[model samples]
Target: MLLKDKIIVVIGGEGLLGKAIVNGILHEGGVPISADIKPIKDSNNDIDYIMVDITSKKSINDCIEIVYKKYGKIDALVNTAYPRNKNYGRNFLEVEFEDFCENLNIHLGGYFLTSQQFIKFFLKQGFGNIINFSSIYGVIAPSFEIYAETTMTMPVEYAAIKSAIIHLTRYMAKFLKGKNIRVNCISPGGIMDKQPINFIKNYNSLCLNKGMLDKDDIIGTVIFLLGDISKYINGQNIIVDDGYSL
Candidate 1:
């Protein structure tokens, strides 16, 4: 019941991580609103869904308007949306320069616009919380050795965007000081989806305990950051990598 009666807006609510965060908020007795470019199918009725294009300032502003119109106030915002172009996942040498810039425009630019709009609303309301997502890659370079045999290699754009997010969180936290708003980031290690066995095995070997993370492993951090318990916490990047970086 950490977030009981609170209203939280989750961008990219249809993605795997976003869905887990939505469920986590509900479990904590908070109202979770899902905002994305597409609608979620077979979603719970308790969750509110809003369509938004983070790349557009109007769309971002409209999203905030919709949330305020319905809930009167937004207690927190969790930005997990990463809209990538078709050229994503390309290997280092295979990656095209235009594709890299496009990915940044859609992903990092989107986060910036959405956050800018919400911070204005938060300013008016006198308080707000923002939780941004980063990756363990942001903290340390990807171990190229891990993906040796697999078709997967860390995309250059991903590393750039995630690293930027961490600094952006710190910048926002400082800019919003004395305005009763807090901004923090979560840098999660690799989440265990159905990756190739070789990749999984290689990744797990570097971890302190379990190799890859389950989606549920990150929910508790989300809840804690969004709740009153973290009132004193701001401008921090909390890494949840299970010691993989070590």
Candidate 2:
């Protein structure tokens, strides 16, 4: 049991990757509390689900209060929330400046707000851990050629937000030095969500092994960082892109 008896709160716990992390934490004996924008029916009696909007300070603070009240002490925080504006995912040329700012404000801004509140709590608690999610594109240039005939294109705003997350991890780790607080980032390649066949073909060609990873593939890293084994591992970006960034 890597995380036995620990209380781990996963923001965006209703998402694709967040769900896997929740299940993985349970498998390793940790108590997981799901914080998402919308409520999800509890399929498992072990999980404590709560409605949270990462974009709002009141919402985030309330979530922390609720989790702390129930769990007593929070051991780690896992952020997978990717809030976006309605006009998110537009092509570069079509993306307006306002839309770009809004996307970053929600996604990256939310991460900052939530982390800030948690870090404050952690400071008083004497220890804490934060795992932020980035993307492989944050580390390398976009493989635009892959989208050749597909209707999909990597949103420019996505790169800005994700890349900022990577550096933010480093900044937080350094800023929180000697506080027993840890901050780290994970950069995963294209996860195996349904996509155009041609795009998949192109993506696979650039990868070393698997073309795209599943949500479960990231759980091991999350478990490690949350557990004591990664006590010294902080301020680093762990890439799980199947070598796609290489």
Model 1, position 66, has a per-residue lDDT of 91
Candidate 1 lDDT by residue in tens digits, 110-151: 988888989999999999999999998888999999999999
lDDT of candidate 2 over 1-246, digit per residue (tens): 999999999998999999999999999999999889967955677788989998899988898899889878899999999888888887899999999999999999999998999999999899999999999878888989999999899999999999999999999999999999999998888988888888999989998877778889999999998999999999999999888888
Query: What are the runs in model 1 whose C-alpha is more than 4 Å off?
Result: none
- Estimated TM-score per prediction? 0.98, 0.98
Candidate with top lDDT is 1
lDDT, residue 115, candidate 1: 89
Task: Give, for candidate 1, the lowest lDDT window spanning 10 residues.
Answer: 37-46
What local lDDT score does residue 105 receive in model 1, on the 0 to 100 scale? 94
